[model samples]
Target: MSPSAIPPDDILLQVTPALPLPEVWDAIVRPEQLTRWLAPRVRLELREGGPFELFWDPEDPSQNSTQGCTLLRFRDQDEIAFTWKGPPAFDALMNRGTRLTEVQIRVAPCPEGIDVTLEH
Candidate 1:
């Protein structure tokens, strides 16, 4: 099916980390930080429409270990949105093929620290 014809089904994630916005933004964009916390390996280009890929199992060295994704939007220390094409299991759960899904992350200052909201 064409991308435009795919129905939308998004997953949202939210968290309030006891850290500043800049730190949170760095953790999201920096490859080193992402490898430490999010994925086994991550490659990101800090620009709109840039190519991005995430390796969940770097040791596997196979297509199944990688997630072919992309960066769609970026706002310094505020928000970043990306396209996530995870494993086939995820696509099966979403009832779609290999169509990319949107994952948007927004950061805002809160009384405690920074509020990070991730919507996919």
Candidate 2:
């Protein structure tokens, strides 16, 4: 079956961090900084219209993190939704498409810290 056969759903990941909302956002979402903890390297054009790219391994930037890895949406110091593409078997079972089927991340403070949640 092709990835287009599956239905699309909004993936949400939330986590609570000790730091403030803006601080947490800077630490986790900022492209260059995110690599230190999250991925190896992230090039994010944070805007309503921008390209978001993440390279899991500095050695190889062409391959997606998995299969459907892409950035869908991002809210400053609040939320980030991205396509999760990895593990062929798992990707077929969960993520199989030009678009991402799963998002792995943290959400902090509806108004203010970090609330982290993962959705697929």
Candidate 3:
């Protein structure tokens, strides 16, 4: 589907990882490691209706975080979904604070590889 076709309520980002489900999930979900690749610092409670925040700088520590976040769904190393309600950054300039409401991530284990789908 095209970017325009995705509802304003949902956005999807998919990635294929060469590692096992647990390994991939751990690396992606780990706050410290996630900052290195995805953002700067990630703080997640990994629970239903918990707060999930991502900071732009780890060293500064006073930066604004992506707030109003919550884990809506989770299935161990299989699937996860959360609410992403913070202001958008440079990449998502048009969507800033627009309630791109739900971010859904799915982990599919197949014979050849594992498909990681992230929806924001």
Q: Could you say which candidate leads in lDDT? A: 1
Q: Give the deviation of candidate 2 from the true structure as CA RMSD.
A: 6.6
Cα distance off (Å), candidate 2, residue 84: 2.6
Q: Which of the two, 1 or 3, has more TM-score?
A: 1
For each of the candidates, give the backbone clash count. 1, 16, 2
lDDT of 2 by residue, 1-120 (tens): 123543464433345666766776687678767877877767677653355566676575544454225567776655676655654546656544655554645564654445656666
Model 2 regions more than 4 Å off? 1-14, 62-69, 87-90, 104-106, 110-113
Can you write out model 3's per-residue Cα lDDT over 1-120, one digit (the tens) per residue? 566788785657777877888888877567877776877768788889886777765565443556556778877888777766543344364335544457777787876678887766
Q: What is the C-alpha lDDT of each candidate?
A: 0.76, 0.59, 0.69
Model 1: ten consecutive residues of lowest lDDT? 1-10
Deviation from native of the Cα of residue 9 in model 3, angstroms? 8.5
- Compute each candidate's TM-score over C-alphas: 0.80, 0.62, 0.71
Judged by whole-model lDDT over C-alpha atoms, candidate 1 comes out at 0.76
Candidate 1 local lDDT, 38-114, one digit each (tens): 88888789898786778887776344434557788998988888886656555665425656667788899999898
Positional deviation of residue 30's Cα in model 1 after best superposition, in angstroms:
0.5
Worst 10 residues of 2 by lDDT: 1-10
